[model samples]
Target chain A: DAGITQSPRHKVTETGTPVTLRCHQTENHRYMYWYRQDPGHGLRLIHYSYGVKDTDKGEVSDGYSVSRSKTEDFLLTLESATSSQTSVYFCAISESKRLVGEQFFGPGTRLTVL
Target chain B: AQTVTQSQPEMSVQEAETVTLSCTYDTSESNYYLFWYKQPPSRQMILVIRQEAYKQQNATENRFSVNFQKAAKSFSLKISDSQLGDTAMYFCAFGRGTGNQFYFGTGTSLTVIP
Candidate 1:
């Protein structure tokens, strides 16, 4: 297991409120990814950072945003929380960008919006 | 959908028995990678097996093996001598050639009954 950790393992926020989930990694991985897990959707990529300050949108990046100011931290923020945005968010890291699916995932953060 | 498809939503196997989970994807690219990730009740995503598209041989680790068919775009996971601890949700993922993003299937839930 890579030294990856997600903060606020569980969170509850009201609709229209701002929320942020933090993912921290101790390993010096170059690529980091954010994903959301749902019942029927499995896991959908939200955003990913290939290097410091280099981020890209995913298939489900409409309502979310991410920032990677440094190599070890990736922050996912929901500008305004919505009910449909409630899901388990996961952070993953890979040693190289070419090995996209070969990643180590964090414990995951469960967020709920009322 | 270029997304990976997992036909089995749930399955059960007797302890020590063998079980196979199905996965299919749509892609025209020849160089890529396939991965199977296991998520247990602890909500931890663990990488089970990985197969590179260029490899003709299947990938295996201990009791976990993959049956990868490039022409058919099918990648299935086979578990041998299944144990109680094998109960978990399995996800199939597809990453394109040198791409930074991946597509995941909904996932298949496997339960090994003792």
Candidate 2:
């Protein structure tokens, strides 16, 4: 266990509705990452944070935003959810940006946008 | 940009048998890392094993092992004595020692039949 938890493990919302997913960790790790898993595409990075208030976009960042104001919490928000945006979101944490060690993952959140 | 590829979309093995999942990647960096992750029906991503590109020796974790062919940019996972619990989706990932992003391959769904 990496001491990670994702809230609202399952959700269903209509298109154009704003949605937020929360990832909380107790490990006090320095780096946190958000990824979306979809069939035929594996997992794609959405965003990542190296430190509190420090963030960057990943391969697939369109229509998504992230916030990390504290060491233990990273939040992902969909400004306007779309059917195409439905996916299983995962949160991962590492001790450093280099990731010399393996990353620890949280149980994923499944979101469905109609 | 780096990319990882898992050519097998699905694989099956009888209990107590061994199974190998193939993964290939494209990268110009000589120093990096490779990982195999397992996601069960519960939707939790669990690290099965990891290998550093600089290490000539393969990495092993209990029943899980990796055949890391650095020259060929291939990282294949070998699961020995497969069990019913091993049924899951397996993903291969690549990361540089100094970078924050992890490039993932489309997963292979593995079934361990009794």
Looking at chain B only, the TM-scores across the models are 0.97, 0.98
- Prediction 1: B-chain TM-score: 0.97
Q: Chain A vs. true chain A, TM-score per candidate?
A: 0.96, 0.97
Across all models, the iRMS values in order are 1.6, 1.5
Model 2 segments beyond 4 Å from truth? none
Error of 2 at A48 (Å): 0.4
Mark the regions of model 1 whose C-alpha exceeds 4 Å error after superposition.
A99-101
- Alpha-carbon shift of residue B104 in model 1 (angstroms): 0.8
**Candidate 2, TM-score vs. the true structure?**
0.97
Docking level of model 2: medium
Q: lDDT tens digits, residues B1-114, model 2?
A: 899999999999999999999999999987789999999998888989989999999999999999998889999999999999999999999987885578899999999999
lDDT of 1 by residue, B61-105 (tens): 999999999989999999999999999999999887675577899
Lowest lDDT block of 10, candidate 1 chain B:
B94-103
